[model samples]
Target: MTACVTVLIIGAGCRGKHYSCFAVHFPSRMKVVGVADPHTFARNNLQKIHNIDKKNVFNDWKAATERERFADAVVIATPDRLHKAPAIAFANKGYHILLEKPMAVTPEDCKEIASACKANNVMLAVCHVLRYYPASLKIKELLDAGAIGDICHIQHLEPIGFWHFAHSFVRGNWRNEAETTFSLLAKSCHDIDLINFWMGDKRCLKVSSFGSLSHFTNSHKPKGAASRCLDCSVEQTCPYSAKKIYLKLAEKVVNMEFEGGATAAFTMMAFTERLGTRKTTVYGTKGELFCDGSGPVEVFDFCTREKTVHPTNKSTVIPSQLMGHDGADYYLMDSFISAVAENKPSLIQTGPEATLQTHLLVFEAEKSRKENRVVFVETRKEHFP
Candidate 1:
């Protein structure tokens, strides 16, 4: 375990390259020994950067799994639908796994992946990178220390800027639910996970959600709009014109009522101007916390009638390429590498069980949205196997 933890990259896409770059930053702690990506450019890109041998490079995950395990762990950064098979296959091969979020498209597939890792005695860490952020960690610490007393309610808003939504959800890889999954699972699963994390052990009892592909559908397409934004004559003035970043629009809202009467309402939007911020408000018995997802967290203590600002960690030097999610991407891989190097799963806050718990929450929320009714949360004792 003390030796460098070598990783095999599956799907050399943005996330695949992002996690593997941790080896570049801390070569002594980790190493990238192999990669599996269908694209020749992506595969060669990783090969040139990591000096991976030709034999270790694969056209796809199936080819990688066909060989005996060559690394300590495998990073499953495949698309949402492609996650299940490789995750289960690698886990069966006894490779610790760093799976991307929303483990799979379906709850059954997610459970099966978790079961495979558990049966093989291989560790699984889902990429819930939000939990690794300094700001998020600071929030968790203050809540755990009872800085705000018993939690009563939380209002969380993720204003995914117009450009971001158009690029990723409207025109990019995650556009269609048929291809990937719903916006809730594809985009905001981690946000729900963070809220559940702040709730600590308080189980979510009832969940109700309301949202849809309201504005992003064909019905909203403006007159004279062409299928391709560049070809459209009205592209310049149309809000959703692929050529221009549109205005901000609220996409969905998920409301969860936890066991202890604590409620959380999460609002996710895509049409708003680029806010680049997660606005959060936590109201507790004794006080409240207000955070703009950066700088300092403000806590208002009712007893003292005073507001105190707690500054978050800001000294970590993040590389420009891997600065996604406020440099949280670096810390997530760092924790995963350390856990693998030390043979300790405890270091990973987003392990299979923890992620599965919140993933189920997300599924339920989505279910509630689609069914147009409240959904009661369910937990199974044998979730792993």
Candidate 2:
């Protein structure tokens, strides 16, 4: 059956457009028929690109959803705090939802969103993109085939590049937990989701985490250095200079090193070691699997004493060849579309219940860190649609 999945993009931010991009390639499978964003310029730009009708564009998601109930799905990429209302409203209005991760920023809100999805009988796919990556799929396949045997423990690292952390968590949109959420939920929720994905039905029962903003606080400010990079005398020596990131990114665009405009801009942030990092390792009864966002997926078998690598040269950090976070974004949308087409509960592994469990674990990790004790997670009763 044809997809004909019409999407209402609730937020016109880069992340929203990233998934909305699916329509550009598989126009027949899905398309953004409407967009709801407060930014007129963003709505206008999307309209210009996808040719959505003026009547379908609105300054608010609530108003748009109220006015139109025919869209097949709604992609809620709104800010961390603004997710629940729109998601609940749309689900009640009979729209399947593709939501961003850290579901609703708080445990209560996460529960509410999951409850609403269940109550309304709508498919709620939290955008845990890592679960959809080809490398992740391969790892899952390996584990299922008993290449890694039964699980043991997992070691995961989110090397939030220094500048990346500063840009997003210190000086950027998610810097203040009061406004958004903690670094764990805002950035690493999906990361932990990937860990859960590999762990298979084995839940992360006990967790104790340790992390902090040790490097970006006001005390860390270099003496005599101005607040902004441009005004700082030691801007050149500053490891996390804004000038370096944008300039290099602009140059890549000029040189045509990146094909998609958004993908190129994404590379601008990712290619720099100015300080972003994510690496994960899964240990099982038989072997281990290692993978990082910037590089290859590696597998080691203790029984055979063998190891193998795929998709790149050795275990080194590899530049993204195309957009969608090494194609995870595209695969995520593709899976969602398949789910819609087949009217199945889900096409991929993680959904509302699983994603909610993952987000809660991050919360548990934070709690463990704060209280200085190990935390245990109870078995989650709710499952996803």
Candidate 3:
């Protein structure tokens, strides 16, 4: 094992806490040395978990990254729009970064973040966590060995479930593109990134897409329907009731929801409520690969006229404890910590630069949808102003 790596976490929200849970799981391998979050409860929990000094705990990332590099690396899990300043500062300050996806909200900010990381010689890894799933890893192995032969095209779907979409994209933090980012980048950058990764650096030439908030907007709201679920007369039959997830009292959350500054109760409840599905189909000359993230991956061989199924991407043992994302989340955090310890940027497949193209591909797809025209992906040199 490499030497233990210390990570300071910014933004103790949903994702920040999810990745930092690794520190709690493997004390000998890694630790959370400092945390900066405006939420007092979150900051307090991080301190308790890692025995962090009050001096090392702050309310803002500006304060966290203000001085001598306190830890070997930083985990910038701040929201999509707020990534640039902290990312640029910490990179220039010579701290390795594990930044969340949609590296920045705009083309200019994305380019600037990558340039800053490169110029400072800092390792800036993006949170394209889907690549770390054992199932995904197995798929990569199969493709590399010609299990699927030459690739033709790929089809992917992210069924942002009826209620899940209503809760998040329609009425929650990511309701519109202006505040957070396009739903494509904010939500499904992982799918786009993985498609690019599996294609082996062959640039996405062009893509066209079409989607809309067809069912979730005010236009679809039933007549006399109360805006708040609890107050609505048709709450039981509305199909989009908060009661389905939250249950009974709208304000009452799950037990131990925020105990010990950990969000186990909240995480479990939220994920359990999420009925979303992600599926990917990669077409190849010899065969085709199909996978439903909620289930197994199957390969169909045209020559042999047979099918092979992998329950967990051919993994010898599907880890049972990690319990979320098919254990990809745990593996991703572990690999990043290991890479930071060894000072090797190649410890994982996804990095800041590679993900930039994937992010751009999403932007192009969005353009295609809005303008109703095919958008060609520009080469790497052609990206940004």
- What TM-score, computed on C-alpha atoms, does each candidate reach? 0.95, 0.86, 0.88
lDDT of 2 by residue, 1-385 (tens): 6658999998998888778878877778988899989998987888878999988988988788667486888899998899999988998898989998768877888888888888999998988887777676777777778777776656655555656665776678986888888777777666667666766666455666655556566788888889778888988887778877567530011000111111000111222453434565767778888877645678898988898886632223322321556566766787898887679875856677888877877777778767777666665763222
Candidate 1 or 2, higher TM-score?
1
Question: Per-residue CA lDDT of candidate 3, range 320-339, in tens?
Answer: 43445656777777778888
Which 10 residues in a row give candidate 1 its minimum summed lDDT?
Answer: 241-250
Model 3: residues with Cα > 4 Å off, grouped in runs: 248-274, 294-296, 310-322
Consecutive 10-residue window with the lowest summed lDDT within model 2: 250-259
- Per residue, candidate 1 scores C-alpha lDDT tens digits across 310-375 of 999864688776688888888888888889889889999898788888888888888998899999
Query: Model 2: what TM-score?
Result: 0.86
- In candidate 2, position 123 carries an lDDT of 94
lDDT of each: 0.87, 0.72, 0.74
For candidate 1, the per-residue lDDT at 273 reads 73
List candidate 1 segments past 4 Å from native: 245-250, 380-384
**Model 2: how far residue 148 lies from native, Å:** 2.6
